[model samples]
Target chain A: MKYHGGHFICAVWKLDIRLWQLLIMASLLLAGVWFRDFSLYPAQIAFTFAAGLITQAIFLRLFKLEQHGFLSATITCFGLCLLLRSSALWVHPAVASLVMASKFLIRPQGAHLFNPANLGVVLGLSFFPETWVTSGQWGQDLTTALWLIAAGFFIARNAKRLDITAYFLLFYASLFLVIRVAWYGYTLPVFFHQFQNGALLLFAFFMISDPMTIPRHHKARILHAAVVAVLAYIWQYQLYWNQGIIWGLFWATFLVPLWNHLFPAPRYQWQALSGEHT
Target chain B: MTTRLIFLLLALSISQTSQAFCGFYVAKADASLYNQASQVVMTRKDDKTVLSLMNDYQGELKDFALVVPVPQVLTEGQIHIGDAKLFKHIDDFSAPRLVEYHDEDPCQPPVMYEKMMSAPMPTAAMPQKAKSDKSLGVTVEAEYTVGEYDIVILSAKESDGLEKWLQASGYKIPKGASAALKPYIKQNLKFFVAKVNLKEQNKTGLKFLRPLQFAFESPKFMLPIRLGMINAKGPQDLLVYILTEKGRVESSNYQTLKLPSNMDIPVYIKDNFADFYKALFETQVKKQNLRAVFTEYFWNMGWCDPCASEPLSYEELKQLGVFWLNQNSNAPQVMSGGGVPVQVTRLHVRYTPDSFPEDLSFQETRDTENFQGRYVLRHAWQGKPEQCEAAKTYFEQLAKRHEQEAKTLAELTGWELSDIKKKMNLNDAPDQESTDQWWKKIW
Candidate 1:
């Protein structure tokens, strides 16, 4: 069937990538909860989304800003539910609210400064005594890993930001290989085992590859990804900190404005891309 | 009135004793129960680590030698032979316990289980030698005798040199040990080699070798499990008792699994707790492909639920390398559940060299949640049948519960379901119920 011009272009290009993101994230959540014994309760998940959405709504009304959508808030909630673990139920919603509020409260240049999920996790771990991130929750399972990579690639492709994911994974994996195999005299399988991690893959495909939070310019984004990868490797292997990807991303967000200033490009608009194929 | 008051006081004392226990402790599975198991007590705060390696070597004292990778050269003051009782204390305190709870009378007003308490029963539970040469690129950093062992700290340039030096010094180094030594050597880690000094051993008047304890400062919070795996016969069991200031210590490299706990099992398990525990562990190890670090227990060092034994005294903890216990001047003499500074996380791993390639890297999580590999054995009420319907219902449910317990045991130990049913004697009631039940085989 033949389609109309602009509508078809919109359908093909700017098809609310958040919709795909939500679907992917929801599937991941379901898979984690069902298959992996990911130490999450249904009530905790419900409370997290409720708290995040309510906080986002309140902030939008208070600031008198045009309510873009709850899509971003939903994504952030899913990310929090997927990552953060606590013995107490209240930590989930409390961290969710603070993370959502930060998105509105700590706007550096009319843009959300930190990735809400990353900020919430880092802050939750640092501030609260009970909260933690279970990096080994996703054990080295080949089938689950391949599925995540495929799904992540599809989502990134839809967002038209696969380059960042590709670059981050490449740099991060290569650095791990170098350290383990070249420097440490470990076997080749040890280098490959690092790639089979579900946490690292999730961070690369979902967290670090967030199109909105990363640098706008392509070159700046590449540089930003590389910097985060290096910092994460250092934070993990050198400083021996947990949630290295999160801490690295949290620190690297400070440099986004610098990268923006150095290599200025049009701010990424969710609805700007139209399928007038390049 | 005076007699009544005296009776009340007597009752109060009895109730206090009952309430003190979380459950009726029946049996325990400690480190001493397992063959070929090595226990290591690691007291870590910041970069400072005090590791006490418990030697379970049962062979001739002369043949026993230990080679461990250390981050720095340990001086004579840094190395000491620790009291063996420290391990026994920690092991008894943290062992996976079997707790029994007796059922209450169904007709009576719901009284606490403590009121109907029954008496709890107690249940019973590496090498090196070295010679140095400049051509072999082996350097002996320090040499000393600590207690019954002669200790030497060696730093090597290559694996071959390390192997040759050890062989020349009359230490029986395992084949392929050189390959294992290479990684640690390349990382610039020094080796702590200990051999039994027969003259010193005779002086101690002890039949068993004492645990070797050493202190060091390093950025790496890891146990070099790879070196231990070099010449392991089958899979080796390593029980790590990590004493940290904050929270749980889990393997960063491999998955750290909390052993399945708090489930009711066949009451017969109380008699065979050791066998049951071995089977349960073997089943889980098989399920995880022998690649998981199972957390047998994690709790505040001061207290326990259904405690297998008493909490270690401050002096005992200090003897076990807990240096920070005295930091808080106002710490309590009698330890309880909460407000204890030191957290004990016990991790058990049945790992082979192939399954675990890297050394066990650890990260102390902020999760202060208490966990233990505790099994429950609910003792059914031995009372006779009464005219009341409640008693009848109770008996019926008890049978069903017994069947469930049998099934749970079957799942846990991979025992035959029929065999467990026979052992539990839950066959007659369940069979009758199954025949009459409408939902049974309806599909």
Candidate 2:
């Protein structure tokens, strides 16, 4: 194959990536409108579109992420959607927007910073005690569980962090068992409901799978994901009634950079012997 | 550094432990009109010292409970009344309860101190033989009930022999030997109980004895009289006077009368004296409009010299008389500056340490000089100015009287009259001029 001109490559790349970005945005808006509630459709749709474009622009500038990185952008957009929804549920819209804006200004390092949704909601709740964020609309039923598992698995596959995903699932399940035994008195249905509750499935898939912020090494990423899963499970089941996924995402993001620094990525050199078809 | 840290930790632990038990209560007592009944109860608790009052009545009650950790005996642990006291033991913890009355509105309950006013008088005869041999001297006995406790006061001459007796009898003479005796007597005094005569031997069940209620008179309304002692020892030179409203003898509405001589004494008071006095006065005023009459007796006679003597030169005495005349005389003379006719019944000079002795003597001499020189100088300087010009003419006549008397006394005492006149002439001459002229000079 002959090498293509730089402009031709750039135009094609932009067109393809923009199409994928638009698809991801539409899916997020539809999910917010349909699954969340018809009442919240307008606000959720508007906030998701604005937040997605703004966050993508911010991450592109801060991390120099390539235009073709549709998987990374889509994952981030989903995370932002969940954050806006959670913030709106837990705190006043104005306050949640203010908190989200604060995260952008304070730590602009994309997913490497504190998980925007979790930090914002926790801080908003702490600051405004009279407000409460709840997921009362999402019924704790089996249908919700299947929907979360499917979505989580799909996102996990797209991000190509299968080992990290598996580790998180095992860690969360084990933690749930321990918490159930210690505090709630063992019940299978309670455990299932706890796992399926509010944006947990969405967080597990989109938030936890941010490749740029997650460790590249398989073992390190698995361990980081496991820690995040355990923390999330404890916060949700043991602590009870909290933004557990937000905390989980924050811990995972925090640990990834530390793990990367400690265990540097393996370097691959170009092999001249490949010219001879060896 | 480690020692300091350990010490800090130790101090913190000690403070926390102490704070756990140190507490107090705010108590309120109410009594109804007609003195029919009363009720006393605490409102809130601080640590362990439950603030309570003593009253003789029956009613409903309300109070708050505060639990803490430190032992209640520490000095920092105080029940704040006007004068707070520390809780000596846990049993001292019971605060006064509201009295229960069946059918009457409760009156304001008597405060802890006022309860003393209602105590019955002690009988003239001694109830029991003196526990000590030296206790036979004059004893002043007083009894009063405060809250649920009875208080008595007994004053007897101090005797070493009594100390020995109490010691030999295994009685612990409490610390603060002299002060503790009053409470001891109050606690031990027994009341007489009447029994049914046993002439009818066939009385099946025991008949009851007549109940005896102690009779106590309310204290007279009195202001706190503070006597200041100047150059005397042992309260000898001190005289105290308490002035009060005419009809209310027991009411606290009276003021302390400050006599000219009282200014001589040095004033010293206990730390919470003001609070005690205020609480006392408030309680007395609530009962009735009150006043007090106080008289002082010197423990020693030597300090009475200044109080008894009258010292003034003849000319000085005349001037003193004239000064009083000036002060007592009405304005706008009755007869064209001829001096308004007035009777002088008494003229005397009063002195105390607070009074400047020098100023008194100077005033006396100035009045004696007849003010002749003053009038002459004023006339020469301004030719009869308005305002006080008529008074000046009257002062001139009084000065003439003083001059004659000063000379007479001077000759009789063999003193130089010139020296007396010279002193009298030293009074400051008045300056009278138009405001315009005065401003002209200033500018």
Candidate 3:
């Protein structure tokens, strides 16, 4: 989007998709707190931002990556606040700093390897015994799932990263259908019930469709998503580990560079100073 | 706040449970409440798990049979008969409690005081077998007689042979049991079949069947609910008590919600606590469309805030098969009387086969936050409203408080609002008439 002239609509049209992402995430958090009865506190959210933004600033100066902005950090903070739940207050801030630091530390080919929020959840669940991902906190409510999808459609449309989300959902639902519905004789409601999960939908639209961490080429991204689906199915169903959806993406991040090398394309940029889509 | 021990009625409902954890009480007995409600106490740490199934089979001993899927065949040493009293005590300890508080004199400054009318606080809280056959593609791995029960472990190649084998063995499984049993068979899970041994049952001379306890190690932390749904008349209720070393336990596949607690209700509910609770639970089940698991109580066994039937003692904990703690080396070093902070989470669910198609999968989370279904009752002082300025304020507050309590009860139980107001004598209250502008008061 570019500023064609000094018109209000043109200015609004020039808004980056990430700004919509930022607004949607904040609204979703509020909706979760109000409607879903999320067991989250304002202090935890405050601490997460306090830690995440500070870590982002320190890394920007320390690593001389000032070209990047705080939008991603803010979005990651919302993700962490939404996904990670802990009884202790300090776990929020501590994990926030570590996750923000990971964005800079765990990079390959000058791009972040793991989604910052995905890595946060993975590390928190793996290392901190006191922290956990409440996967079932978001019940399989149809209305909530639809709301996520509607919001996702609007935001992901502008980002032009809908392929991975679509691919991930297809592959994941196929695995679920084949195993639970077809092989195990579970009713189709059970299969559909699994997809109506708000957490899973949120992962599809917000987490997996993240343009930076995903492969640049379209085909490679789809393949990457399929790999995630299979690995996540094995991790959750076969290996019986908790939070396998996020762990699926966490494990698949190692293959991003390989996918990029296999099918090459230009790196994604959120901002083009001269205003270009690519 | 001064405490008043007026009534200690715990109205928490303990579902009379069996099934979907697998098998049926078979047939030809009173298929009523006990058939619909099944209770299981599962304790886990690491890969080790001990499951105690409460078999409240209110039927003839010959007809009572239970089939459950185990990850592997259990040896004779792995099975034992559990004390029925343990289930009762654990139920009472975890049931929702009603606490009462009396309003102090408004003229005097606030003072903290404690009063107890009774020494003991009351709470309302409230399984088996297997076999094998060959050439029918069913293999009976092992059989044993363990105290009033004949247990057989079966590994079936397919559900058809297993169903036939069970029927041939005089187990009288329900129709369509094969379809229900195929998933487990496909998963290669061994089924443990238990039947009441008439002679051994007679030797015990006890009317009720003792709980069946099994100790095993499996990485799959889940309970199969599909098989039990085959025997369902409508919606079945399941009550699970999870004891874990790390923290609270929640179903990974189903949403686990905490029941509304610590709310004030009308004083008349003290006597009608049981009916109140039943209505509240039904209302919640209906509201969630029978798709969620409700956490009634979650607290560490070391201590409780109001101390509902003294936290399970170390000996009692061991009896429940909590394997992480050692009796000798793990003595309490601090005031937390118990060792290794055992957390007990009570989960209840009401579901039909349609609503819940999959087995309940659970994961232990690192949440040590204490929660309980403690309803409060506030007793208004009998002083006249003309005594002092604070007295006038207290009387006004009391009327509004009563009104608020009435609304809460109606909302919580889905009761008729007018009927609740009639029960509280709230419609005729003079203060209600004084506030004619509803919009002005709402703000």
Candidate 4:
């Protein structure tokens, strides 16, 4: 198979990629239905599906996410779904849909100005005074942490950003240790829960590993990821303000281009010396 | 370089060691009581003496004496000795001597010694009685010193009391003798022992012609006796009964009394004196009774103002019908919106235009008018003509009641109706004509 833009389907029309992405998204939807034990009423199911699809379509179109291709659309949709699920605590489904729709207004370009998930959570919390609720469980519950970790590892490997991932983990661990010592005198159970919970695992693998947003050089990428992880860990566990991962990812994306310009690695040179005609 | 490093280390160690014991110190003295004409001797640990002589008493200590340990200097104003701070002036001294001391010296601390010395003296001899009789009490004489004054207490028997006392005595008790005798009697009386300023008087001898009976009286019995003396001139021979149990003067029935030459009688017993007595008596009675009162009322009538309305009942609240609904049921939900019932748990009401007998009615009308006006304005701005028309009908009835209440309040308070109109800022009365005109313009 021939490749365009490092993807086998990149040469295909943009609409075809979108259609393929939608099929994958539908399969995810079916998985949710199959996994959930409580049978949703047909009307409820229809409403839920329609709300998700309309919100996803409206925000994507408004933000011009199509220009970024199927990958961007898929990542944005996945992030939006996870955020909406989390925000279901305080707001009605329709209101959550409306909140998700507001992403287009806040987005600067085809990509989000802030992390869409973090912005959605903050906007929902502030705008709807009566019904701002939090989804207490991340993924499904504590049990899903292992699956998330495995998925993160798989994603990191495929992105060929192992050094960057390792650096991120190391930097995060150090920051966590420092803050834990300062706050609780040692690393606490709550600190581990904070690391496992929310968009942290997903963000490390998906957002930080974005090839277009991060630096291309291995060393630069390592530094970039490490900085992001440290900042994110500080914001979440140390500062105790929500949406640290989003801010970390946003800042790390900006820093990648700057790091590439400032710290370029020396070019490889091999010396060829001829023995004097022996 | 190594020598310099060693020197630096030595310097650091010296500084650190010296820093521990360095603290501020204060020296204090009371100059007023201290005789500046005499020399001051200060003893030190080395048995060496620092002397401040009479000539060293300049108005400011800084002018004459040297402040030792040059960096630490003495302040010139008033100095504190122990807890007491004495001024520089000589006459202000009440103590016999002044002591000087430093606060920081842990060993051989401060010391004080008396500046003046005196010996205790014996009492003066008492005069022997000339005669003794059974009717009067035993004759005795005593003398005591009070500061510089001498006082004597003398008692004579009845046989030597009247005529012999007149002959033997150089001074005769005044003719209507009760006046002169009153103070002497009061002094000797046992009832006055606790209350009088006997201990304060600097006296040596008390001479009594007769031993006055000392009977203790309660405060209740004494109060009236005190009041009688306060009212009357000179001293009256009054028959006073004292309440034995409660310490009060029961009565003072005054007879004819002679006036002293210097005394102003009427001005001394003014109306204020009577008022003071009456006030004291009334306060006592009120305290005995322990009477006080408090009352509160709560009521709910039909209609009221928005801000000052009674709480709505649960059934009444159900009419709004908004509920909190959780949208994402799958996630651990923290909040929700939709039809969640809210029940009114408390009620409070406040009324104004208080003088108007129909204050509740008046407030209701005013509140209704204001509410309707706001509603109409909002609907009109929203382009909801139907709602605005409905609100207009509600406003018409409100305007009538407001006018009636305004007229009633004006008449009751004797205020001009025009003043009421001005205060309300009404362009014209809220009659049918104005209402029709207002509607036409708005529509």
Candidate 5:
């Protein structure tokens, strides 16, 4: 039991959950490009990764922050590749750099202000004429939707932020049910159709539940999730706009500082994710 | 070689027979490919939208029924009957094209390239009805006779009352339609009901009903298509021509996929391009499981590379409900890139009731990149395979290319590989006895 070789193996076994996150995100992107016919080109995706990682390197060096790592930035790169679409080549790298820079530059307190990829997409959709989000890029196919939900659940749990995802989805689904089915008289399938969306699930588990951005207090996080849900609903149904969830998260970001101030909780550390040793 | 003029025949889905260039251009695949296909042209800018709906109703004129839920009650000036030729032109312009380019002589450098386009298909549909009465919770907002048709606009408080009013007015209402109409009614949408008036129809002396168009202002950028699925027997084909100011229009809810395009196919497909296209589309829809909308074409109004049909003129564009075109006399030459900036997006969907649970919603993006469903055919030079070293090498590569083309055709259409090989006549090539054969060197 005291063998040095055994100790080495155990250390390797306790690899960071961020590596698992990178793996899951990479697989989802690959599956979308190959089977789902995502319009993302390989060169564009490479540019995204290059821009994200390079920016992360620059920021880490600028602050000389040895504790920060490339894993989170790389994850944001995958998020950008999965959500953002553009005919022009430059939009991807530009968006990735802006969002990665946000991680370091946009800190409100000790935590980053917005989920990098979510804010990147919102800014791209707002500012860039060539860029757009293919919210329906992943069709409402059962296999893809199930894979997203299952993968999202895994990561949300490992990151200790499953509460936000669960609450956000619950609140959003109930809103759809009440307005679309009960009030508007749409059938149940119409309501369920929205659930099968890959974009919505991706936002719930990945964007809204971003542990670094959401409220640190448990109760505050739940309230944050519901606020995002209602804002997203209003953006989509009332305004008849696209990228509702993305904008929803972007607008909800302003309240995070207030939530953290009111409901104080201990600061989060990457090592906390190792509690379950996933 | 410098002066040789090798005529390239472009079916343009253009020439049904005569591959004549510098002459007449006809569309290849018209909307007659399907049984019950309905075509709609929607041109919108800001809050103003003009929608034109085309129906090929072969049934008894009295039984032809169309009830569309609209955002506002359309006035008489808002309604107009349009020429069917406009639909034909737009369909031809956006149809998936089969372009054929002949290879230059192996001994000489290449020069010429030609391209052309084709048609639209049909789908299944049922009927809808409505009326206006205070007691029945239906208000007759307006009535009009735009062309050879009687039109009525009715605002209703409930779906059942609207259905009853239509039924009593002798309109054919499909069963369970009230359920489908409920959502639109609750959304406060008024109904635009139209039926053919046989007496006025005889005066026009046209065999088919002209397309119906209406212009209105609304924030909703959507097509009320779910109501048409009330009594749908099976999946139906819908061709939507969306003209916008800045960029392309895509479904906000459903996946907007582009058909696999721009590949080389066997020259034999030239004879049966229509059937080839049908197979290509059917196979793609099967792959998507009828769950996605396909973008057949998206291009600016300025020009076409190899025009499938002559670009729609400004007058014709206006007739097709492009309200944004300026009244300047110079705008008539929109083909010169000087007219009002309009981009057309042709979206095709083979939709079933189960796959499409809700009405389609759309959004316009600021992307002007042009795309089309383009297929290519490469014809070999007529030079002798033994004419020169280049000729022999060309012949060798040609045989291999044909083999690959056969495989591609099978993959695209989900056809039998063996059958494609048989059709390609891959057995009797002269390359079999070429001097480069390894057996000759051994001897």
Candidate 6:
């Protein structure tokens, strides 16, 4: 029954990673709103969090789920705030509520089927005409890019999800390089310009690399990254669709169940592994 | 005196009283505020786009030529000569506006001010064959004489061959144009080469070039700015007026930022609004390192809150390539009886070759939020001491407000604070008697 020093340290480490993610997300939102002049209103952000947390509480109560906490909801709220834009006040909260509800409702084999933020954005865009994401809102600036990459490395390292992030960036960047530089004969700066987008970096590190929603096995994860990258490239370059990354990830989500079935691995638990990389 | 040919489009004023509580429009800061600014009006609905290109090319008529990259070879029917007046209407409607509001009487109900200050306006070629050999790898896909333009649509097999073909035909293209043309050629985009047809020009009897418009259906909603930048002197200004059915159109690759708007500056700006906007824009471009596309105005064509110019009429909107307007006669209206809802997003970009390497690509967002680069000038209440306490207190607050406005102008234009204060005639320095009293006490 005695608690050991290692046990105390492990408990602290588990909370530390979530704290880091929260801090990074909050700072990025602040930078975006303050310096980048994001078209998000204060009331929209407040309502989004209220709707996300309230819906999460309601779903927890109705489902009689025991593991009820604010950490996951907080992460989802930040993600929504970072990506979703709406002139109307209702869209953010409405989308946030649906996203939080999906975590409980859309359960497949006791795991959330889709990333909560990603689902919310895709659905919001499809259903509401007023809601859209501005991918170019975060233009490629050297200072901001370095800042995001540095912070993203810390979060990815702590989460042990760097494999997916690395693979996703590699695949996406190589395609851009080929199209902009080699085939088109554009200068190297054009290639760098496309790759340095902050939205792409944010997507690579934060949204698509969500641990719980991704495939459980490493091989499945790599495949998932490659497929999403290819689809995103085609969507943006070939089909000329906006929000290609979001669309790619949304379509790629259905493959998770198949991937997990083929290559089974232990289910990821936030508490079981500390900030230590596996 | 050398004869200066100035073609003026008669300004048609459509006066309609606005019901919205937004301030009344006093003056406009149009693309004319910038020198060498090229105006392009692009109306897109889904995959269909109609682009109207107008430039102030004041050189010899024979030397005037424009070569643009088209997604497909445009037929003669796709090309039309647009009325220069339509550009004026859209520009007058969506140009960054200066609106005035009179400060109410401190002792009585408010009265809005009506005085306005007006500002001064700021005020491609071809290929040859020759090496007309079929083996030169250049194919002229289509050729036509539309309006006063001799148009040739070319699809090239290689950049070198295309450059050689252009040179052989006496199109005087810039030296580095081949490198710029390679990417568009690789993308299979046809080159739209146009030069003035002297015979047609003489028949038109107009000194200025009429805007050239082309309607095309392609999945790509982009403007090829790279080809234009090849021989650019220093920096070029492009005023892109985009009209979409749903919402705002924004640059996909570059940051699309709404210019600083809805700020109250000094009333003196009403007289010098042109100079103020020019300096303000220059400062913003420098601050962003000249790497941003600035949205000067985005509003529904149905109505304007402050009627900068009257909302373009249904006929005018149709002329600007709003093909969806006829189909959706019942499109959602922002204002009752204000015409069909067509969103106009006026984007102004000042780009150097270094700042912008790629052609500007755009996407129409579903955000229907209305925004405009509107600056306000509030005329202070001129009440006497015979009035009530409110009047007395208003003067005290007015001084502070004036100081704040001066600071804002300085910060926005990168002007010296001292110089702005001097210009503002901020003479509220500590009284000589008060200073002497303090000195007397010390002595």
Model 6 docking grade: acceptable
Cα lDDT of model 4 by residue, B184-226, tens digit: 2332321110011133322423221111111121111111122
Better of 3 and 4 by TM-score: 3
**A72 in model 2: Cα distance from truth in Å?**
5.3
Off by over 4 Å in 2: A1-32, A35-41, A51-78, A83-111, A115-132, A179-184, A266-278, B1-443
User: Poorest 10 consecutive residues of model 6 chain B by lDDT?
Assistant: B1-10
Best by DockQ: 6
lDDT of 2 at B185: 30
Error of 4 at A121 (Å): 4.4
Candidate achieving higher DockQ, 1 or 3: 3
Please provide, for model 6 over B104-214, each residue's C-alpha lDDT reduced to its tens digit, 9 standing for 90 to 100.
Answer: 888986655453422100113433332335777888888899999888998898998888888788788788889888988898989888888889999999999999999
Which regions in candidate 1 have their CA more than 4 angstroms from the true location?
A1-15, A271-278, B1-22, B113-130, B327-339, B384-386, B436-443
Model 6 spans > 4 angstroms off: A1-16, A271-278, B1-24, B109-132, B327-339, B429-443
Against the reference, the lDDT scores of all candidates come to: 0.81, 0.33, 0.79, 0.32, 0.81, 0.82
Q: Write the number of the candidate with greater TM-score, choosing between 2 and 3.
A: 3
After superposition, the stretches of candidate 3 with alpha carbons farther than 4 Å from their true spots are A1-8, A61-67, A271-278, B1-35, B114-132, B329-340, B431-443
Give candidate 6's error at residue B180 in angstroms.
1.3
Worst 10 residues of 1 chain A by lDDT: A269-278
Q: For residue B234, give model 4's deviation from the true position in Å.
A: 94
Tens digits of per-residue lDDT, candidate 3, B18-109, equal 11111111111011223447888999988899999887676667777788889999999999899987887777778777767778899889
Q: Which tens-of-lDDT digit does each residue in B1-443 have in candidate 1?
A: 42453244234211111134446787899987778888999999999999999888877777777888999998899998899899998998999999888788877878644443221200001243445688999998998988998888999999899988888887777787787788789888999888888899999999999999999999899998877776676988999999998888888877778888889998988889999999999999998888788899987776666778877777777877788776455442333435468889999999887788778888888777778888998888777668476888989888778878988999999999999888887666557556678987686
In terms of lDDT, the best-performing candidate is 6
TM-score of each candidate structure, all chains considered together = 0.90, 0.31, 0.89, 0.29, 0.90, 0.90
Evaluate candidate 2 and give its CAPRI docking class based on DockQ.
incorrect
For model 3 chain B, give the 10-residue run with minimal summed lDDT. Answer: B21-30
